[model samples]
Target: MDIRQYLDSTYLKTAQQAGLSDAENVEVVKAAVAEAIEENFKLIMIRPDMVAIAKQMINDAKSHVLVGTVIDFPEGKSPLEEKLAEAEKAIAEGADDLDFVIDYTAFKAGNIAEVKQQVVACTRLGRKHGKIVKWIIETAALDDHEIVQLSALIKNCVITHLCEDDYNHVFVKSSTGFYKTENGKPNGATVAAIKLMLENSFPLPVKASGGVRSYEEAVEMIQLGVKRIGTSSAKAIAAGEAASGGY
Candidate 1:
């Protein structure tokens, strides 16, 4: 199926999370960027701090792999100004895509106005800078109804506040690949959740991320109408092997 084009090979672990020293963790990110270039994946998703290094590596290799970085990362609790500043820094560092974690906690808490403001401001910044923007809604942290509402919320915000052309550049991504669920539940993209996102966020595109570890799973998400699949197992999935990992 030539799945490489649909994959955003990702590595977002911090040194502490990976149980490695700072230098060792950077090595991990370097290896991932190297692998993405070698495998010809569509993009390499890394932390904001790693964006410049990854960009340098890709440029030196003369590869086409775009560099993507997370904004406010796995936690989307940052204030609006902070999120904007982080994203601006990432853009200056040569990131091609900006994946912002939407303030799902605030949304769940009924602070819809604040959430909308962040979405509009961040999406506008990305569009202005000519970067692809994706909003990570952290679906696992939300119920089914919240998923639909949040997806629709992003769509409406884009369509109403931004131009029609921005729809293609912005996406409603499924997760941050870091949410913890109760009772051992799946913490990433599920078919039902992806479906809800796709149905509600139509025309804006959906990215099924988190916990997608196999070729079969990636294909399933594609069939359900996702534009991209974010996973740490992109290489294995591309080879038609089942990958074992959390992200």
Candidate 2:
């Protein structure tokens, strides 16, 4: 199934988060960019600060790989204005896609209007700049019911105001690959959760992210109608080997 085009080769760890020096972080982003180009992966998702370097590297190599950045990433509790500003900066720096962390906490707290508004505002910004907007619902932090509910909410919000052309650009991504959960608990995209999201978010595509680390898992995800697979293990997966380190 040509899973390479469905993969978003991702490396979103910051220097501080990875416990590496700043220079090393830059090198990491550069390496991921190079791998994406060589492997013919779908997109390169990096931190916003490193978007320019990734863009330059992909451009210098004359590759058409799309560059993407995360907005209010990992945590989705940021104020709407702050996320908007972050999106603007990423777009200005050549990010073709923006993975936004939506405030599902607010939604679970009965703040549906606030959550919907945030989605509306962020999608508008992406549409205005002609960039794809993917909302990370952090499914690991929610139960099956919550996942289904949130997927429906995002679908409804995008359809109500966003143009038809932009509908395909907007997606319901499963995780940030960074959310924390209880000990011995799964903290990223899982097949059952992804299936639930796919079953619920009609027309709006789904991206299965996080713990997917092999060719088999990726193919399984593709079979479930997942439009994209987000993983740091994209290189190893494509090579038909297991990725040792977790994302």
Scored by TM-score, the top model is 1
lDDT of 2 by residue, 1-247 (tens): 6778999999988899989999988998899999999998999999999999999999999998999999998888999999999999999999999999999789889899999999999999999999989999999889899999999999999999888888899999999978878886778788899999998888899989899999998998998899998999998988888897676
Task: Name model 1 segments beyond 4 Å from true.
Answer: none
lDDT of 2 at 136: 95
lDDT of 1 at 222: 91
lDDT of 1: 0.95
* lDDT of every predicted structure (CA atoms): 0.95, 0.91
- In model 1, residue pairs whose N, Cα or C atoms come closer than 3 Å (at least 3 residues apart or on different chains), thus clashing, are none
Decoy 1 TM-score against native:
0.99
lDDT of 1 at 174: 94
Error of 2 at 52 (Å): 0.7
Displacement of the residue 167 alpha carbon in candidate 1, Å: 0.7
Query: Which model scores highest in lDDT?
Result: 1
